[model samples]
Target: MGLFILCFLTTGGALDYLYFDAFTPSGPTLPAATLFSLGAASMITLAAYHGGGSLILGSLGAERPDTQIPEHRELRNIVTEMALASGAAMPQVYVIYDPAPNALATGTNDKNSAICVTTGLLALLDREETQGVVAHEMSHIRNEDILLMTMVSILLGGIAILADLGRRGFYSPRAGQRLGRKTPLLLLPLSLLIGLAPLIGRILSMAVSRQREYLADATAAQYTRNPVGLARALEKIRDAAIPFRGATRGTAHLFFTSPLRRRLENSDSRLAHLLTTHPPINRRIELLYRMAGIMRPPVQNTRNASTRSA
Candidate 1:
């Protein structure tokens, strides 16, 4: 929210400077224009926040899973088990027909939330692994990470919208006249800041998302009492060579794993780490195994250890 306000001020100030001559003595006062911009941005952001989950699910083509299918039925059962274990209300369930293995939870709160998974996930993971994934999502609901993420997504959108408006203002006849009078040195800095605001907001949003994912992994282990199940699930997802066709930059962070796969996601470089949405998959898997008090091993060996631990 603080980030959104800062972006609002920066972008709004740029627009006011370009179009309204905010610094000129005869023009509207800078403080008044700023207040108006802040008010407008807040309303748009609130509306988006209220409808964020539905918008995200609709964009992904998520729909209620057909319970006639055994896999779908099992998914609901696992959701119920995890909900009970975590003491959260049963979230509405939906499925995407995409052939990429991924899942997400979304809503403003526990009572209103929904969980959606891909058909590919049902096909790829066994019962235990499915439960593990479901538990991770349930942890998101129980911890109110859903609300946190929803707010961040909306704020990022708000920044992008403001940036677009700023771009449009630059081309307007009135703005061009005002620009002629303004010092070139003053305009340059404001233009550059407005252009870069969205990129900065995205990097901050991804950092928040990565931290929440780590927390969700730990909470899922506590709920299921089986960290290895989630560890193995992460390993499989990491190795899967499929692209999520429904993914977009705006919605990628909502998924269990990053829907848009990039080679940098696996890189150890600090710059690479900042550019990725989620933490390195291998790092997440290793943490889950550590929670289980076991050294990470090959998939088959981990399976045997999982069985023995169970």
Candidate 2:
């Protein structure tokens, strides 16, 4: 968040580095801290309001039951049943169009939780594979990982805004400019560093932690009673080179698989895993391998449900 603020402030300074300088009123030039405060408040306020609004609008208008796709009923039923069995309430379902296969669950809290799927995901994965993905997302909802994601975003964004503000204060009016010339070069870079702090913080925040994903996987397996289903699904995702389009770094953690296109580099490589929300695919796959043996038969077979209803 600091980085975001810094970037915002620094960039503003870098550009009109002159504009902020004008604000130092005779009384006590607006404290450089105030600019950062403004940035933090401005950016995060936008993120929270915008993020919360989008989720609401998307569900109310775009994901109405009547507008849901034909297969939505069956999918919803399965998920609802699973939730019931798990002692959790049902989450709203949404169908989104995108070429890359993916799904995500989100909400500020459980009561408001919603799940979304990409057209690409629906079209690409086989039935069991799809189940795996949904189950993974369901796990997030059940565990409140969804809420954490939003919390993280708000915090990160706020930090960036502050960082930006600080940068803006560095350069200023004639008086400030005079100070800058006299100040050590160190202060300039320090100001820039302040803005970058948020970005660094974000990379560290990554996912809910590796253990959470494992537990989610376990929960899904328990729900579906089909470790192979999820395992196979993960394999297909790992092997497929097709990209999950329209993914944002902010939302990547929301997906069952990392939304990032599979790169030639190792996920554990410094660049790949540095601050990603997901653990490496290989590690997740290995856990699945362990579960494959103990995977119990599903108490409710979706295939049977589909066939019986069809």
Candidate 3:
């Protein structure tokens, strides 16, 4: 859904660009989407390597020309092992000094993506659980879901910053100087639109994130050879109230669970749950259980990873 939206927005922008070329009114012309896609793709593909390294240890209420990863040794090793087992690119790893039990992967694409985890999370789960978390994120990497998600995040974030500037334009002394009466009228609707736009974008973004999560969970189950362990890991994170201290909403969806949130008690409700990025915990557990039928593996849990994974 987010990929579609990103393409749609870029399409809209490209159309705006092409409409200006109407003066030529030439015969065969490229669609707006093609040009927009090329521009966005070129940016990601060209700058991915540098961007990935820079973002790997960027701002977390600190300053460093080049910040060194805190737990580089273990995290990097686990990630490398997971990538090898899965036959995927070894995602770069970073640690947030924050005391929240959460982790996330971010980048323009697989080539440039960075995985970040808070110190709190490092302290929270055991190595197997950590492996499950890493495996899940790797699935995202393998599935190529990062491109659309990263685009949606950048677009929505820009829209928000632009909207805020638009709002400030009204009160700033520069308002009358830069924005004429026509400008205010123009910004009025645009501001309202931007304010609400991220909400809608998030819904769609979460929808895309949700599906990737299910697939990743299935993938983790396959790799770990113990659906029960992965499920148990999720259960611990879900039940733990240790909020990930510094996880901004900008990258929260990349975590193993809702890293900063406690499990919703009413999480089972149908209507509200639809809005969540992850499938319901019960749904995830149930899906893991069904894996037995699909993958035909041994069940380990005394009760059931299905019932408890939730």
Off by over 4 Å in 2: 1-68, 161-189, 207-211, 262-266, 294-310
The sequence of per-residue lDDT tens digits that candidate 1 reaches over residues 121-158 is 99999988989999999999999989878767777777
Best by TM-score: 1
Query: Which residue pairs clash within candidate 1?
Result: none
| Candidate numbers, best lDDT first, in rank order | 1, 2, 3
lDDT of each: 0.83, 0.61, 0.59
> Which residue ranges in model 3 land beyond 4 Å of their true spot?
1-53, 60-74, 108-111, 169-191, 262-266, 292-310
lDDT of 2 by residue, 254-303 (tens): 66777776442225676666666677766666677678764432223233
- Residue 192 Cα positional deviation in candidate 1, in Å, after optimal superposition: 1.1
Q: Which wins on lDDT, candidate 1 or candidate 3?
A: 1
Least lDDT summed over 10 consecutive residues: which range in candidate 2?
295-304
Model 3 scores worst on lDDT over the 10 consecutive residues at 14-23
Model 2, position 51: C-alpha lDDT score: 76
Best by lDDT: 1
Model 3, residue 95: what's the lDDT? 71
